[model samples]
Target: MDIRQYIDSTYLKTPAMAGTTIKENNEVVRSLVNEAVANGYKLVMVRPEMVAFVKRLLCVEKSKVLIGTVIDFPEGEGMLFKKLDEANKSIYDGADELDFVIDYKAFKRRDFEKVKTDVIECTRLCLDHKKIAKWIIEVAALSDKEIISITALVKNVVLTYFSESDYFNVFVKSSTGFYKTESGKPNGATIHSVKLMLENSFPLPVKAAGGIRNYEDAVQMIRLGVKRIGTSSASEIIAGEQVSDEY
Candidate 1:
């Protein structure tokens, strides 16, 4: 299936958590970008600040691996303008795809309008800039019904505002890989959650993120019709190795 093409090799750790210095963290991102290019992975997902650095590195090396960054990150409680600002900067800094963490807090609170507006603005910004947009609904934090409703909500907004050709450009992604559950449960992509997302967001592409550790799991996601799989285990999966990392 040329799994490399559907994999987004990702590293979204903060500088402090990732390294002691900016140089050290950037070196990590650079290594990831280099590895992605060499391995023919589809993209390298990094923090927003690292987008420009990755872009410059790719330019110098003449690599075609896409640069993707997260917006609103693990927490989607930021104000709309702030999220948009982050998105704009990432795009200006050469991010080709933006994975936005939608305001699930608002959705859970039954503030559907707020949630819808948040998604619409961020997605429209990506559309205006001709960049890929994926909404990270943080499935692990929600119930089955919540997942279905939110996925459908995102689909409705995209179809309402965009053309058919642009549907694939917008995706309903599974998780942010950083959400904490009260029970300390696994807070990443699961087959059941992904199945719900796919069934609800049919025309819009679905990206299964988090908890996808091996090639077999990735292949299963593809079989479920996921367009992308986001994980730090991309290299391991591609090489047919199993790792114990949760990203």
Candidate 2:
């Protein structure tokens, strides 16, 4: 399939503590949402506090942007109840979709049951609010075995939620863009994780993120079975800076 048709998912990951500042993250979120809409990007991941502001800013017939706010981003080790409350608030605040991080420690400890329950609760929160839920398995922290296991666990939750809820998302993300080195490439672990998510979950859509700096990488990721490419470089990708000579 041609990669250009794929959507470029993104996030406005302002610091959680930005509310302490004078301008506040909400203003930043509003400005960013307007710019993104003006630029033609449709999906953006936002913080809980910014959800309502972004929804209003991007809600237009010409824009039609969708908001996907993160629950316990970067690290999913927060209390499940707290995450659910955050998700609930985001939905109430007007988020169109929800993206939540799974607790890595739970997965590493082989606590599949805990993982399942947490996701179920999260999904339940979304369902109760009538919103879409996208489970973000931070693939950077898991090993290959752990990745596959988590994928299975997500598949199970997705199936369960779909039967009971509006929709289920099986997006295995690369990284939160929090970890970086001089190389600045998405970790090999994340790549393997995406490969596994795509191979194991054929019918389920995969969202590849992190270190997606160019269009060629985006297209290549789609060829590797990713249905959506999440990156901070959405403008670059849309501007054709990421494409290659052949394209």
Q: How high is each candidate's TM-score?
A: 0.97, 0.82
Residue-by-residue lDDT tens digits, candidate 2, 125-148 = 776666766667766566678777
Q: Which prediction has the highest TM-score against the true structure?
A: 1
State the lDDT of candidate 1 residue by residue for 1-247, as single tens digits: 6799998999988777765588888788888988998998899999998899999999998988999999998888999999999999999999999999999989999999999998888988999999999999999889999999999999999889788988999999999888877776768888999999999998999999998888899999999999999998788888888877776
Q: Which RMSD does model 1 reach against the true structure?
A: 1.1
Question: Candidate 1, which segments miss by more than 4 Å at Cα?
Answer: 182-184
Decoy 2 TM-score against native? 0.82
- C-alpha local distance difference test of each model: 0.91, 0.66
Clashing pairs in 1: none
Best by lDDT: 1
